[model samples]
Target chain A: AQSVTQLDSHVSVSEGTPVLLRCNYSSSYSPSLFWYVQHPNKGLQLLLKYTSAATLVKGINGFEAEFKKSETSFHLTKPSAHMSDAAEYFCVVSAFGGNRDDKIIFGKGTRLHILP
Target chain B: GAGVSQSPRYKVAKRGQDVALRCDPISGHVSLFWYQQALGQGPEFLTYFQNEAQLDKSGLPSDRFFAERPEGSVSTLKIQRTQQEDSAVYLCASSSPREWGQPQHFGDGTRLSIL
Candidate 1:
């Protein structure tokens, strides 16, 4: 019953401009949220994770996402976009159904296009 | 070598042919997962294994899709009677058992193409 929705299917931004990718989730339990990036023909790389520790979580490569409980949103952001930032971004949610059921649900994904 | 590894980076077969994909998890990872990713779509869960126990296989699309983690380390996903709909990138990921909220490490994936 847990699901994640990415607001945009594609986002275009100029180099040196700020970037934003919006995501929302519906979960019955306190969720563990994550952001992952995948390049063409490459595996998905974890960006950041929120495990009930901090609302604001920082990730690799100058990326960050904030977990808003009231709004049920975990949107990813970057201070400035770079040419290398072009990739597919996914928002994930895990219900934490004990140790046996750690399956994570993924959003449809938003493709980021950085223009030079 | 340090991350999850999947074999046969690309596979092409006839519609009726059977294909097998392999995955080798990290040295000590206790949880392994298989996912199917169609073009322009997010990965969908297929099955999961905790050590050698196949705990969940509910996400499997049909009986033709089967997966197993035999020795708690190596896993294989076999698709019998492959069809055009089964052509997708099959991804394998592993995570540690120590924490329920741990992030998963992924493989580059095996791209299966059914002709």
Candidate 2:
């Protein structure tokens, strides 16, 4: 079984300040983790993905997330928040089923609000 | 044009009515996925297809939901006898191949409002 948990439903950060959105996961197999952002009325855009290669994954728009196996966490972060960064972020985990079918699980989501 | 495309950006249908939504995935992509997203929520997987083969439909909510990708290039999701709870944004995504750590490209999605 695979599951993702986004710790915060909403996070408000002041412009020019740092931002953080926490996420945790549980997977019986080696998981493929991802962070995706969705602006209003827009499609989901992949921020980054964590394969086994590197623990620190950098994404578009100056965002990045570090995969911590010991903590079972993949928290997204940014050095400074921008007004355009306001959006909903989802944490996802993908694993193979017993039949080898890909099964992806998504978190409830964390809404980021940038305060100017 | 290079990314996935979904039809009927917004659709309004009466309860008990049937509706169909379409998805056109990226060219040469071997994997396609359908998901249902509710208000202020992350997407929930509905089904997956590897080319024209419907390998998984376990996430489908009910029998009223059906999906097909006959030719492997395009896909359609049909809902029979829709209900109020069925109102959601149906999202479609595609990936290059069935590989570990493959990121999916998504379409804008179809907002279906059941009246």
Candidate 3:
């Protein structure tokens, strides 16, 4: 049984400011983690993923997440926030690092709000 | 052909009505998934299909919920009797066979409202 937890239901930041959305996971096996962004009335877009590779992962739009084994965390970050960055973000844990298990679990979500 | 496409972006139904939702996965994609998302919540897996084989249906809420991918290309989810609790966005996603870690591409989703 794998699961994900998003620390914040919502996070607000000013334009040009750095952003952080925290996530944690629990898996019996090595996990495959992912970040997805969903805009209003739009489909989800992949941000990044970590599958027992490099701890630091870079994604589109300058977004990135670091997989911390000690902390059981994969937190998304950005150096500067843009208005287009306002969207709902999800952290997911795919069972067994995706080689065998395709079952995925999602967090409730973190709604990012960019203030002008 | 550009991406996964779902029919009728929105649907409204009365109690006891049967509704069917369609999903067209990416050309030659091997895996397809169906999920239901409530307001302000992440999508919940309902079922999965590998080609035309329905591999997993464990997440389905009840027997009233059913899904099928007959020709290994298109799939359908049918709700036998609409209920207020069924009012939510139904999302469809598909992934290819290149990598196990490949993220699934999603459709905009169909917002089903039961009245």
Q: Tell me how each candidate scores on DockQ against the true complex.
A: 0.85, 0.84, 0.79
Which pairs of residues collide in candidate 3? Answer: none
TM-score for each predicted model, relative to the true structure: 0.98, 0.98, 0.97
Poorly placed runs, candidate 1 (over 4 Å): A98-100
Please report, as a residue range, the 10-residue window in candidate 1 chain A with the lowest summed lDDT: A94-103
1 or 3, greater by lDDT: 1
Q: Model 2 chain A, poorest ten-residue lDDT window? A: A95-104
- How would you encode candidate 3's per-residue C-alpha lDDT over B1-115 as one tens digit per residue? 5899998899999989999999998998999999999988999999999999998899899999999999999999999988999999999999997465778889999999999
Comparing 2 and 3 by TM-score, which wins? 2
TM-score of 3: 0.97
Write model 2 residue lDDT over A8-106, tens digit each, in one string: 999999999999999999998888999999999989999999988899999999999999999999999999999999999999998754674476888
Clash-forming residue pairs, model 1 = none
Q: Considering DockQ, which of the candidate structures 1 and 2 is the better prediction for this target?
A: 1
The per-residue C-alpha lDDT of model 2 at residue B38 equals: 95
Docking class of 3: medium
